[model samples]
Target: MAKLKLTAGRVRAFTCPADKPQAFLWDADVNGLAVRATLGAKAYIYQGRLNGKSLRVTIGDVNVWSLEEYREPKTGKVITPGARPEARRLQALIDQGRDPREVKAEVTAADIAKREKTKQANTPALEAWQAYIKARASKWSERHKADHETMSREGGQKIKRGRREGMPDKKEPGILRPLLELPLSSITRDAVAGWLEQQAYRPTRARLAVSLLGTFLNWCSDRPEYRDQVNPDACTRMKKDLPKPQAKDDCLQREQVKLWFHHVQRISNPIQATYLQCLLLTGARRNEMAALQWEDVDLTWNTLKIRDKVEGERIIPLTPYVKSLIDGLKPARVVLLHSDDALKRSPFVFASATSTSGHITEPRIAHNQALKNAGLPALSLHGLRRSFGTLAEWVECPAGVVAQIMGHKPTAIAEKHYRRRSIDLLRVWHVKIESWILEQAGIEQQKEETLKLKKSTAA
Candidate 1:
C-alpha cells in the first residue's frame, strides 16, 4: 500500500513514485479526497472515487497548489477539508445526475460574455463601429465594403482627405449616432420608430437614415453576441408610421433627354462633359461608370461589362460613339481621370478628385450644377438611367429587353422564377437605347447608321 507523509507544520505531500508504473493512495484516511503527481515532469491530480471505481481529476502542479488554498466545491460555498463530509455530499449530487463542475464552468463563461457586451455598449459609437468592423468585416465583399464606406460618409459625416490638395472627401451625415452606442438589448422598435419620425422631419434624409439603420440592425443580428439582442418590442402605433424610402430612380423622357443631353454637352468641365456623354450612350449607373476601370471594359468586343454594377454584370454593347468617347479620353492607361488615385488606382471609368472612385462622387452637386446650367429642375444622376429606360420604351423595345439590358433579373411569380435568355433580347435593347440617344442628341439617322438588329417578339 502506498502512503502519504503528513509533514512539519501540517503540510501534506504525496511522495511521487520513482517507478514507471505505480499507484498511490491519498486521503484514504478521510472521504472526498484527491491525489497529485505526474507521468514525467508536470504533476497532476486524481481525485474522487466511489465504490471500487476511481475518477481522475487533474489539479495542476504541486509547487503551485498550496494546502491552505484548497477548499471543497459543494454547499454553494468554500469549506475546510475537515468538512470532507459536505464535499462528499456535493459530489453525491453529481452521482445522482448533477454536474456542479460543468454548471460552474457555464456560469463563469456567461459572466465573461456578459462583461464583454457591457464593454462594447460602453464604448464610443464610432469606436464600437471600429470594433464591430474588425471582428466581422472580413465576411463582406469588396463592393459591400465600398458601399459601407460611402454610406459612412452619406449617413454620418466623418472627415477624411485625399493625397491631392484642393480636394476633401465628402462625408455622410451622422444618422447612426442615436443608436450606435446603445446595446441591441436596450434598443426598441418604438425608439427606432421615434428616430424614424425624427428622420421624417427631413423627409428625404429620414428615409435614407432609417433604411441604413434597419440594414445595420439586420447585420448585427448575424453576430453571436448580438443574436438575442434584436429588439422585437416596439410601440404598435409607431410601427405603422414607418416612412417609405424614396426610390433611387431618375429615368427621363425623350423631350427631357433631348434637353439634358444638350445641357450636359455645354458644361464647362470637360471631364463632366465626357462623363455625361458616356452616361447617355451606355445606360450605365453614374457611379458604376465613375468607378470603371480599363480592365472592366472589353474594347475588342465593344462591350462594357460591369461586374460590380448596382444590378449585376451589365453587358452593354459599345456603339461607335461610345468607342469614340473612350478613344478621345486621354490615355491614363488604367487610370480614371476623374478619380485621383493611381494610373490604375481604381478600375473606375468615372472617378472624382475625392473618394467616390469616379472623381464624380456627389450626384446632387452635378445635378444642381447641370440643372442650373441647363435651366431645369435639379434631376438626379440616376434620373439619366431612368431617362435611358424611358426612352428605350418610347422606341417600342420590349419591356423584358429593356430590363435585361439594364441587368434586371426576370421572374415568373412569374417575374421571380422565370429566366429569359436575353442575348437575343439584348441585341434589340442595344438598337433601341442607342437609337433613342441619337434621336435625342438630334443626330439624324445616317445612311450607314443602320443596325440590322434582332426583332423582339414580346410586348
Candidate 2:
C-alpha cells in the first residue's frame, strides 16, 4: 500500500495499471479512507477491521465527493464534510462495537416506514372501495357488482343515449363520488350524515348507498391494512333520517290485461314484445328472464331453468304461449349469425346483438310506450311479474304452486318441509293459470291435448 496526501489533481489522475484489475491510493489524513480505481471507474472507499475481521464499504464517486471539507463561499456554510468524515464516523461506530452496516439498514428501514405511513394517511376512499369490490366481486351477482361500480363512478362521461335536446351531454357524478374522493380516514359519521342530507332528493337511492357504504366500512375494518383508517360506525344511525322505502303496487288489473296485451304485442321489436308478454305469463324476475341462455330453455321437456337467487336454480314449466314466443325469437337469432351455419344460434334466448352483455338490457322504454298507447296506467316490468301471481288467484291455484313457480322462498312448514310437488304437477296448475290469463286477454292458445300429441310425435 502507498500512503499519500490526497489532493484534487492527484485524485483525478489516479488510474489502475493495464495488467491489474484495481488499484488504491491511501490517504494520509484519514486512516481508513482511500481512492480506489478500477479499469473503468474511480471511487472513494473506506476499509477497517471490526471484530478482528476486515470490513470494506464504498463511500462515493471520486468526482462527486471531495477529498476534504467544502464550504459555500458567501455564507461560509458547510456544504459537505466529504468522504473523509464519513469514513471517520464508520470508524467511530466500529470502535464502539457497533456495525455501521446495521445502523445504515435501521435508518433506511425507518425512512421507508415513515413514507408508507404518510402514503396510507393520504390514500383516497375510492382506492379502498375498489379494493373492496375486487375482493368481494366473486361472491356477488353481476347486477350487484355493477351496482357498487355505478355508485362509485367519478362521472362526467359522455352520455351515449337518452340525451334530451336541452340537457347536458355529460353524465352527472355518481351518488357516492364525493365521499369516495375524500381520504379514507376522513369518513366520519358526521361526514356520512352530511352526504345523506345532500342526497335527500333521492331518498331511496341514497338509503341504498348508505347501506353499501356501511358494508364497505365493515369489510375495511376486517382488513389489517385498512382497519386503523376506517370507522365502521360511520354509516350507523344515518338511515333513521332517510324515509323508509314503500313497497311497489303497480300490478296490472284483470280488466286491463286485454288492453295491455294488445299494445305489448304491437311493439316494433319482436324480442321486446315477447319479453314483456313472457314477464306477465311466467312470473319470473326481470333479471332472471333477461339472463336466460339458449341452453337453459328446453322446449322438448317444456321446462325453463331459471337461475334463482335463493335456491341456486329452479326449473319451471315453460307454458304453451311462452314457448311459442321463444320459438318466434329463433328467426331473429338466425339473422344474427356470423356464419352460414343454421344449426348455430345466439347463446341468449332474448339475444341482443348491440348490447354489451349479448342480451336485452333496457325494455322499459318500449314497455312504457306500449302502456301509454293503450291508455293504461303505468306498470313496470316487475309489475308484469306481480300480475302473474295476481292472475293465478283467478284460477284458484294453490299458494304453494305460485310460490314454487315464482322461485319464492318457502314460508309455510308444509311448503318447505313436506310439499315437494313435481314439475308435472306444477305444469298442470301453471297451464290452467296461463289459460285463464289468455282467456281474459282474448288470445287463443293451443290446447294441452295438441301440445301433448306434438310432444309424443316429436319423441
Candidate 3:
C-alpha cells in the first residue's frame, strides 16, 4: 500500500507491481478509501472495520468514474469524481457500525425481489389459470374440467348445432374469457363486478362463472409467486355483487307425463329421444346417460352399471319398459361381432358421427322442440332427473332405494349404516315405479305375453 493524493491522472496511471501481484494507493483525504490496481483493471474500493469485523466494498469501475460527452470528445467537461461520493456513503455506514458489504447485499436482494414481483404481476390471467388447472386438474372430474374449458372458450365463429340463448347467429365471448384477458394483478373486485353485471342477462351461468372464478383466485392465493399480488378476499368481496342462485323445482306433473312421452316419441332423432327417456325413467344425471357405453348395459341380467357421481359405480335395475326399449334397438350396431356376418357394433350406446365426444353431446335442439310441441314451459335436462324422483312417489317407493338409485348420498343414519339394499330389493320398487309411470302416460302393456316372457327368461 502506498499513500497518495488521488487524482484522475494518477488513478489511471497506477499499475500492479510484479513482486506484489497487486498494488493499492490509499487516498490521503478519505480514511480507508483507496484505488486498487489489478493486472487488467482498476476500481475504487473501501476497507474498514465495523464492530471488529473487516469490511471491503468495490465502489465503481475506473472507466465509468466520469460522465462522458462525446460531442466534445477532446475537450469534454470533467465533473466531480463519481466514486468519491459512493465511497463516502459507505464510510458513513461504517461510522454507524454497519458493514458496507452487508448493507449493499440487502439493497441488491430488495431490488431483485421487486423485479420478480413486477414480472409476476404482468403474468396473463389465462396463463395463471392454465397453471392452476395443470396443478390441480387431477383432483377434478372430467365434467369439472369441461366446465372450466367451456366458460373460458374464446368465441367468434358460428356453431353448427344448438342455438345460443342470446346470440343465435354468431357466438359471443365466453363467460370468463374477458376476465382472463387482463393481467392477473389487474383482476380487482371492481373489474369482476363490472364483468358480472354485463353477464347479468344470463344470471344462472353468470353465477356459476363467478363461483368458478373465485375458486381459481383461491388457487392463485395459495401460490407463493401470486400470494401477495392476488387478493384472496377478492372473491368474498364480489359475492355481494353476484346474483343469488334461484331455487329450481322444475319437474313434470303426473298428467304431463302423457304429453312428455308423446312429444319425446315425436322427436326426429331416435338416439336423443331414447336419451331423454332414459334420463326420466332412471333418474340418472344427464352426463351419466350420455357417457353410457355398450358394456354398461346387461340385457340378460336386466341391470345397468351406471357411472355414478357420488359413488364410483351404481348398479340399477333395468325395468320392463326400459328393458324393452334397449332390446328394441338394432343389436347388430351395439354388440361385439363373433362372425363375419355380424353387424358392426358401436362402442357408445348413443353413437353419432358429428359429436366430438363420439356420442350425442347435446340433445337440446330436439329437446326444446319437444317442449314447444308439448305446450310445456322450458325446463333443463336435469329437470327430467328431478321428475323421476317426484313421480316415484306415486308407487310408494322406499326413500333409500330411490336415493341409492339416483346416486344421492345417504341422508339418515339408518340409511348410511344399517341398510344396504340388494339389487333385487331395489328392483321391486324400481319396476313398480316404471309401471306406474307408463300407466300414467296412457301406455298399456300386454301383461300375459310379458309375464310369459319373464318366466321363460328366468327359467
lDDT of candidate 3 over 23-89, digit per residue (tens) = 8889877778788898888888878888887878887778877312133447665554566667778
**Model 1: lDDT to the true structure:** 0.57
The per-prediction CA RMSD against the true structure, in angstroms, equals: 8.9, 5.2, 7.0
Q: Model 3, stretches more than 4 Å misplaced?
A: 2-6, 10-56, 67-81, 91-99, 118-131, 149-161, 164-166, 169-171, 174-202, 213-270, 324-347, 351-356, 370-379, 410-419, 439-459
lDDT values, one for every candidate: 0.57, 0.87, 0.80
Clash number for candidate 3: 0
Q: Residue 136 CA error for candidate 3 (Å)?
A: 3.4
TM-scores for all candidates: the values are: 0.60, 0.87, 0.72
Candidate 2 residue lDDT tens string, 166-284: 88999888899999998889999989988888998788899889999999999999998888888999999899998777788999999998788877888999999988988899999
In model 2, the runs with Cα more than 4 Å from the true position are: 68-78, 161-169, 222-228, 335-344, 446-459
Candidate 1 lDDT, tens digit per residue, 329-439?
Answer: 545334444434345554455544445444555544555667677677656666766776777766777776666666666654655566555544575567667866776
- Could you tell me how far off, in angstroms, the CA of residue 227 lies in candidate 2 after the best superposition? 4.1
Point out the worst 10-residue segment of candidate 2 by lDDT.
449-458
Number of backbone collisions per candidate, in order? 38, 0, 0
Q: Rank the candidates by TM-score, best first.
A: 2, 3, 1
Error of 1 at 286 (Å): 2.1
Candidate that would win on lDDT: 2
Candidate 2 positional error at 178, Å: 1.3
